[model samples]
Target: MRARYGCVCFAVPKKLIQHLADRSGDEGHKQMLQAQITQSAAMRGTRASKTVAGVATNAGAKPLQRSVFDAAGQTFLPGKLLRDEDDPAGRDKDANEAYDNLGIALQFFSSVMGRNSVDNKGMRVDASVHYGFHFANAMWTGEQMVVGDGDGRAVKNLSGSLGILAHEFCHGVSQHLVPGGLGVVQVAGMPPALKGEAGALNESFSDVFASMIKQWHAGQDVKAADWLLGEDIFTPREGRAVRSLKEPGNTKLTWREDDQIRDYRQYKATDDAHRGSGIPNYAFYTAAAELEGKSWETLGQVWLKGFDQLRARSTFLDAAHATLNVAATLHGKGSGTHNAVKAGWKKVNVLA
Candidate 1:
């Protein structure tokens, strides 16, 4: 069957790889790392070719239908089923981490957002851990979640991070909810102008929800939250997370550019969707900070509702207008929430 969508993977950034290569004492090891990074860059173009086979779900009102698979460091997916929803935890740490994190993601959507599941129809959540040989990335494969055991030196086992799992899960949520399935427009052979904005929106939405989920799980308020995604995946010595919403340009690694763009004038049209996502991510962060409370409540709700109003080819301005309307509808036009939304967009230069 044709793939449901082409999803983005949370891979180690090129700059990080370059930094690691430069720091390596062994020339042989440096070459290997450089080769790996090059291979990953090439793989992005063929990501859509990877198909995820469908599995039937049991019918019921079960709290969560979760299945975690062990790929056992091989390339094949959904490799031996290690745990199911009813089964007790096994000896495998990766399997257990995957199972627990999937539960957390499901709980966040159901309890906080009042959504049934990723599809809002109680569809089963399936995840595969230990996928590929030191694969160094994680993704939602249109059908299920796949996390790799990262190369120990540069990256860690991705299944261990709750934020990463939540981020990938949110990709599935966006695919099922957003019109034309966000970034999937590019995979469908649409023009670049139509695809870039959708793809950037897709990436930004995932980052926003991922940050929100992490903060909610930690019982952190907006101010207390670190506002970093994939913090757990990177080594502490690296001193940088995958991305930061609070401070875009501030990175632990010196080679990386500031990923956060607070103004439209700073925006660059790049083929890399993740780089282009800084605009919307900063806007969401700005709105949440201005609201100054539990982000998942007001700002999160407004953005969630706003997603439904987004067209297939919606631009950043379209998102700003939709979110403003949502905030005003949720709270009166003159309310704090409405004003915060307006100010957030204006701060990002999306609104005049």
Candidate 2:
């Protein structure tokens, strides 16, 4: 009961493959160029320089001083895994959860997608928890995915949920494929309205992949899904699960502005305050669920190829168009896979 990429290696878009051939002069060379392109494309829509309110940077700042690991082969949680106490105080429990979840996700990815690791290179996946002083967020800081205690309110432990860990780690995957080689393309340098949406799309890709990993572990059923974003991290009193996969803006977390927090609507990933990514997140879930079967198998590959073929500073429409090209390449111009992608974006009000 195993599937392989060889069983379904979507044809690289002819035009794209030809373009790679023309640019690199050989298939191997073209692949290298394409990998570089994919890495660069991931950072296209990120206006990451403005210093968004929740975002943090600093390679040496190990607030929790946690240990990390790389899950290469078959590894499972609740087994031979590290504990949060292996690091600084208060970080042990969460760190343990994060470490265990990373193994779960890695196994799900390899078993399903046939990818060796996030970079398909068996790169060690490092995670640090208890970042900053009560910092209420988690992020992939180019080098590692760090999590905070979430202000001890809405999110008590960022590492408490597998989905959250998977979400942050997926950012690493995005980094490896998209922004990995592009360096850093600031948001201010983007081409207008499409700015945040592109970044949001990147975030949504993480959510999609993370959800797929979770679903795959649960044996492919969303109905039995926890559906709570960072649920384990959030206190029961906080109410609401992690971000919704089918419906956005349907959380119980009520902040100052009900519209902002409770609504949980996904927004275009622009320089528009760095919140509201739920809309695009929901759209991604819709698309993946619509595809059915193993997520990494079909939907994930389509997205990987689509993102790989795009350029830095791409817009939502650009993403949609690139996906169309990839879907058509992977599943023929008139195939159901192509149509599914088109409908997925169209349903979300994003066009091809």
Candidate 2 positional error at 293, Å: 4.1
The TM-score, computed over Cα atoms with residue i paired to residue i, of candidate 2 is: 0.63
Stretches of candidate 1 off by over 4 Å are 1-3, 11-60, 187-195, 253-258
- CA shift of 53, model 1, Å: 11
- How would you encode candidate 1's per-residue C-alpha lDDT over 49-133 as one tens digit per residue? 4333443454437878898888888756667888888899999999899899889888888999988778888888888899876
Q: After superposition, how far is residue 185 of candidate 1 from its true place, in Å?
A: 3.7
Error of 2 at 252 (Å): 4.8
Assess the local accuracy of residue 85 in candidate 2 as a C-alpha lDDT between 0 and 100: 22
User: What TM-scores do the predictions have?
Assistant: 0.89, 0.63
